[model samples]
Target: MRITEPYTIFLRRLPSGKSVYYYQFRDEDGKRSPAYSTGTNKIAQARRVCQRLYNEGKFKKSNEILFKTFASGFFDDESDFCKWKEVNGSSLAKSTIASYKRLLENQILPFFGSMKLKKINTDTVKRWIVWCSEKCSAKTSNNAQSVFNIIMKSAKEKKLISEVPSSELAFRKIKKKERELLTVEELNRIYHSPLWGWECARRAFLTCAITGMRIGEITGLQTFEVGDDRLNVEHTLHPKFGLGPTKTRVCRFVPIPKSLGLKRQCGKTWAFEKPTEEKPCRADYIYGKLMLICDSLGIDHKARGITVHSLRNMFISYMRGSSFGETIDLKIKAVVGHADESMTDWYTYWKPEMFPEIYEIQEKLFKEITEV
Candidate 1:
């Protein structure tokens, strides 16, 4: 009855003419379990069944399993991973959860769907990153890595895997080029191009420039969010998900220019009529309009040379060159809804109107530089 390493089962013939087989093994966790195979008189077949039970940790009626395998088992039990995401993704923002669902649908599930959780490893993850990088942008690749890391980390926290591969190993770096802000001349060219003719496209780009708001913030704007002589940057409309809080989760207001003719229609409503519920304007809608304008203007939409985000950068650059030079950083941060201003060394009390003087100075500098 001595059971040692490489233990074997011996079939014993009972008085009833029945044979029994036994098998045992030490798991990676150093636990042992035994099981009986079918009434095969053959030792090898019993040994094979024993090995299968041992590897799967199903030898005993009740043995705790690794979290990784447990999650995989759960995944197998249900065809849809969205249920798991919703249950486990509570900590993530709604928009983030939606994005995770998309990534899983478009990328993760397609490759790993049939595989057991225990089977996923550094090599497989790295290959997935390579594939994602080939088909997507560097930012997209990074986002996918982030989402995958979060899911795996959640799995590990719940004891799905013994350990998660180091993030350094899981994510491959894709070098991104520095983004250049658009010049005034270039901005003029882009604005004059037929692509900028759409009201939404023109309004979205101009709003970003004037208020230094992110594209999301600009696109999420509702007539209700606009106050007398000011626009609020409180929320953003995600491309895939609907309206959510701003990226920084902080709200700020930008002074509306008289040029836009924004006024209060009556006691409770602002001058800009609120969009109808049936067709509420969204960031993606604005972006689509901008893309259409670019196409009509024959601009290279895919080129890294120019982007809608450049409007915000241009606003920053222009503000920095104004009389509010010293306070430009803080002012920009305030209007742009940046959460912190440690990197920007200006007092926070400055008003957005101070940008006008800076704009005047920038105009002079621009004239001197361009001689136009």
Candidate 2:
């Protein structure tokens, strides 16, 4: 039966050892529901429950009704997304999930949370792209966009939305910058700097310099991944994407100089290792240490445009100046784990200790520029 107003009355004892006391009312949909007041059996408590039910009714409705009331229902099914997150959370690393959570909470949810899934148009998605571009780098904007697209794709699969907005239409073109390289002087400064106390930082830097492996690949290397004085570039521990395949999704081995028997923790073969929980020997750690060294050397680390990746470039350059010139392609490809050999052919390779020849060429080039 429909009750027009909120009120309460105590009923005689039922089969159970309790008396029924509650206010009954029809919601906005004209469906009957009850508001219970157990202990007091009081009208005031019943009315409070009724008020709460009414407030809840304001937002609880079909997708259309929700859109009309809240301007969006995209977040209405957020619990489902939360469930998905929890499931994926277990399979992935904490940092990976954290990054995804940041994108969902800070970027995607803010824009489309309340909007009905079907109502989200390309225009709105484009606006999000513009907003991301204004606030973040192109790479970051693209990553955020990717997360949004993934959600929309899931919604489409679930029939929550008939169509997913085309994300390519919202894409912003980003210019690629040249890779930075450090000069020999800067390298020497870093090697000698006292700021780098953690031996791993120095070793990892030199490893990257000689091996040309990406930071993630270098850091993620387990003892088993190395063999015969060679580093096997196979896996990477991405900051946001978690442990997975390298960018090429291919593994290659990099030969190391036999002169250096870099060993940390006896019987451990991992090229880089740190004391458990004491500190991480990751590329970021090494990069930070390098920055500290740069600061101590009075160098503008930021303006100088040097990065850990520069070590790889130095390796490529050094290889080109060596005697084994034609072998550059195979060596660089093996060291850097390049999937495409054409890209690897860009650099010339020379012998390992041809510093004199390289300096002679450099000197001649400098003289030409100076004389002119």
Candidate 3:
């Protein structure tokens, strides 16, 4: 049926004696199409449902339509929305920007990128979801939709459209993957094991496992940021993005409980300095190289959930001491930098000397309760 064709609606009484709404329309062959249920008892919502369906269905196109009048940009790479933020001296994370570009290149562009902004609505989104379903898993398709939603939401913010196209959109269920953490013994086994030839990588991993700092924080750590019994997560570095903000987009301190004695006092200032040379490695480097050591240790990284970041998982699991409530009782949040501590405090009263006192009880609790 041509989407632009006129549609008519009527009410039908169900066996339960409740009335429901449905819409009927004509097809391209001048044939009457079957009545489609709007699935709502409310007439207003039902009309919205019918309108949304019409917006998404196959429709006639005009070759005379101007492309420039449709949308200022089509794909993620073309958006140039980053320029808006760059002018403000701040920009969205490169990882998020990359995800948008990847989603557009891989899936979103094929279905909706070329379509006019006026043509993109909930109904077309449903068709796009179904189209993505043909090639990828439900989760990946949903991720693509999320990326599309972000782009549309950006357009809405810029006043390109009256509203976000997918504001009312809902996606199919996404199955969760099972993620397991290593036990304390398994952690020790890996920590003490040979570095499979690279020295700093193992130490970097073990520091994350014991202290619960993110891998990026550990890899990009400067020796000055290391203390007698705590590691400072002041910055993180990425391969493509270069040295940048942490996942939380702020500097934080992660406790290095005296139990591990992760001393970074050495020739180089940065932790895990160039593994083969004398320069510090980026966060991505640590994430990329660990699988080789995993192979050497005869560990199946995927089966074991043993990425460099999973070392933080191991730290978290061991910190809780087999009880969920202990996480709060032990104040594990502050130790792991999960505390809602203000970044403003950095300017207010940030002293590396003051942390040892502020975290005094945490240090004792960590050494007392930590499994390893």
Candidate 4:
């Protein structure tokens, strides 16, 4: 049923098969949008709830202010945190939302769920931090604290809490391991190694080394997007987020070495199929594969901090070490899709005509690859 008198209303069925009546209204900016839901399927009940919500100025609250209950509403399908389909909505990457939920369920919610939002303060969170430090890495603990901050901020935004208490209790800095890059010779060994006898892995590994695209980009590359001298580095494929925005939320066109050739479709398929078939290179699989080959070749991965990403670092290292040095430096950044101010904003203007000198260095770099 449609109600288009003072506002617009539509009966929408969620993925869960439950139908809810959603209303569209003009926000402060004078733009029409879906602001909230009626949370019921029966027409008469839905209309009554909608009327009540509107009478209360479209903001509803329960008598009790439990952390668990507020969190549920904050992440409701209509809100931005976990929403995927709303237009002009500020949503986090799906994996991030999932992690927040998981963190709450596993750690934060268990401790704070029954308590009121105002009752959770820095001291309460510090206890959780201490507990997390005993079991998790600095990175993971930091993630939980971040989610906690978001919950507090959201509570304040929704008028659930009068103020956020000690909200600056961000976790301590995390000391990340240095990523050791692979030398040209070491990279060449893996390039030549028959360990990646499978065509998909072989093509994918070579692509990563030469172009320096992220694993997400490499796995998301399509046949139509590959060109003679460039690649449309547009999308990323995350296991949890599925296909969404690139890491930078901007599209980049990366230059490739002419010598780094693909069989028309380097990274087209979404996932792995039979081992013999052409499929998108899985990041975790490639990480393990690189480690396996390194072990077999007597290369010290842990000591060197070498991983699949090291190939991208290797490409950057090659560019920095090349004779073209002072000149074509921005070109190098543009070639690798780096967000460098020295180059064009879109990084799309680097035709071979603009920097003919970089092609020679790229050729020399690619010459080191002993393709499988």
Best by the lDDT measure: 4
lDDT of 3 by residue, 1-372 (tens): 655545778999989998889888654454566676666789898887667545544211222122232222433332346665667765667775776667777887777656676667777888888889898899778888887787777656645566776778788887765677665555555656555346666667666666777776676787777776667687676666666667766666665656555574432667677655667765655666667656766778889667777876656665565444363433465556564645533445444454443245445434443335
TM-score of 1: 0.58
All predictions: root-mean-square deviation over Cα? 13.0, 12.3, 15.1, 7.9
Q: Score every model by TM-score.
A: 0.58, 0.59, 0.65, 0.73
By lDDT, the better pick of 2 and 3 is: 3
Q: Which prediction has more favorable TM-score, 1 or 4?
A: 4
Q: What does the lDDT read for residue 293 in candidate 3? A: 57
- C-alpha lDDT of residue 98 in model 4: 72
- Deviating ranges (above 4 Å) for candidate 4: 1-36, 39-63, 83-85, 263-278, 321-360
lDDT tens per residue, model 2, 74-189: 23323345455557753334455466667777776666766775677788788878877778888777777776776677656755567778545755677876655676666766
- The worst-scoring run of ten residues by lDDT in candidate 3 lies at 58-67
Off by over 4 Å in 2: 1-94, 178-180, 234-252, 263-270, 274-284, 316-334, 337-372
- Scored by lDDT, model 4 comes in at 0.69
